[model samples]
Target: MTAPAKTYTLLDAAGRPYRSTTKGLWGGHRGSRIYGRLDCPTALLALARSTGYAHRRVFFTDEATAAAAGFRPCGACCKDRYRTWKTAQENGERWNP
Candidate 1:
């Protein structure tokens, strides 16, 4: 018997669809890669936004690991959003995380 294809909720700069690996410690390029220059948390947030994930925590990990898990640099794709998130990280801001 064969196992089903493992799928990941990956996204691209323009908020498009693609698949990532079910494996860990991923870096540079994969076979017929789907997502383009997007990261995990950012992808998750984007997915939540478009597909209505409606979860509490967008990602439950540190920035680096979260990114390594497939999250893109929020500073890039989500610039304004990143700035806002950064501010929220500091001091007391409404809409925590």
Candidate 2:
């Protein structure tokens, strides 16, 4: 008999949750709506400190999905993307990615 396949819960472009065999490529905070690398230092620090960040943790299939879900890039991990997002926000323009 074959064992059941493992699955991970990830958020879609619409911020809806779904189960997939593939793991998420990016991580985010649902409350803050900020996404970044799965190995982001700031996120890891928060996780280590047990600041309830894990309770609001979310996972994304990719950056595009995260952006489409109304999430901004993390300045600590995704500096270049965060700069672009920040500039767009400051100029009252929508960020494409």
Candidate 3:
């Protein structure tokens, strides 16, 4: 049997609502990033680590908000979709593709 998901409620930039597992982390350091308090998931951070968009990838205080804002899952630690992303990158489907 699997455990129930934890409840995570928090506010994000633009005053949007969100939820997440463990808190996210910083992708980069910049003053313009109003949501610096926010955090990106480790999985998402991994993707950012292996790509050109490293600077853009980061933790958001509210994860659901990040996802809704167009942020995708991180590929590195996220084993499930890692391969999917690897294939995409190889085929040039999402490498700034």
Candidate 4:
């Protein structure tokens, strides 16, 4: 008999584990310490333009997890949000958005 299928699990923003049936939930860049929506056009364009882009692509279960990992919002797609976060950092305020 065939063995039961194994389920994939990922960490939440709080680092809790949860089952993930499908991938491609969120995208991140390890080099830049940034993350954004999977459908972000800027991220898609960057991925298309680079040869080793796939290696830099990281996935997160949710935005909270991405933020918790110290990933800032993408500047391209999340322009306003990025600006706010940057401003907060510049003013020495804790960023939480």
Candidate 5:
């Protein structure tokens, strides 16, 4: 008998959750709309502090999906990307990545 496949919850470009066989490559926060690496210090700190961060936790397959979902790069983990995103936001330009 074959074992059942394990599925993961991932967010699409529309920020909707779906089941996938592949795990998400990035982590995000639903309320804050911020995405970052799985090892992001800020996110870890929030989680460690028991601040209910887990309830708002989200996952994305890639940066493009996160961006399309209206999420921004995290300043703490994705410094360079955040700088670019911040500049684009300040200039009233759409961030492509």
Candidate 6:
């Protein structure tokens, strides 16, 4: 039989690596440190551009993982969470959302 497919490992909120057969639940832009759903419009548009967004694209197992990595939620797609994060930042409160 052929060799089995290699599984990918992604980081959890605590930065622990875990194996997964599928891609992570969230995608992040390394430069901006922003995370969003896999189908996020901004990501899609960026990827479609001439330069493409793949070079800066990162993956996270979950929102908590992304947050722990210092990534904020996407404003275009995650409006509510972005607002919460922004408010927390402006008020000097902890960013828990």
Q: Model 3, 8-97: lDDT tens per residue?
A: 444354444467765544232222322222243553454566665554434555434543444434443334444654686588775211
TM-score-sorted candidate list, best first = 5, 2, 6, 4, 3, 1
lDDT of 4 by residue, 1-97 (tens): 9987666555467544467765646788878878888888988988899968767777787776788878899988888879998999999997877
- Candidate 1 regions exceeding 4 Å error are 1-3, 7-73, 94-97
Which stretch of 10 consecutive residues in model 5 shows the poorest summed lDDT?
46-55
Model 5, residue pairs in steric clash: none
Alpha-carbon TM-score of each model against the true structure: 0.27, 0.95, 0.29, 0.74, 0.96, 0.83
Query: 25-75, model 6: which lDDT tens digit per residue?
Result: 898887888999989998899998846578777788779879997889999
* Candidate 3 lowest-lDDT run of ten: 28-37
In terms of lDDT, model 5 sits at: 0.96
Residue pairs clashing in model 6 are none
Model 5 per-residue lDDT tens digits across residues 1-97: 9999999999999999999999999999999999999999999999999778999999999999999999999999999999999999999999988
Model number with the top TM-score: 5
C-alpha displacement of 73 in model 4, angstroms?
0.4
Tell me the spans in candidate 3 whose CA falls farther than 4 Å from its real position.
1-57, 81-97
- Prediction RMSDs, each to the true structure: 12.1, 1.0, 11.0, 3.4, 0.9, 2.4
Candidate 4 or 1, higher lDDT: 4
lDDT of 1 by residue, 1-97 (tens): 9998886543333334456554322221222121223354654555567544333223221234433334333454546645765676575664222
Question: Which scores better on TM-score, 4 or 5?
Answer: 5
* Residue ranges of candidate 6 with Cα displaced over 4 Å: 9-19
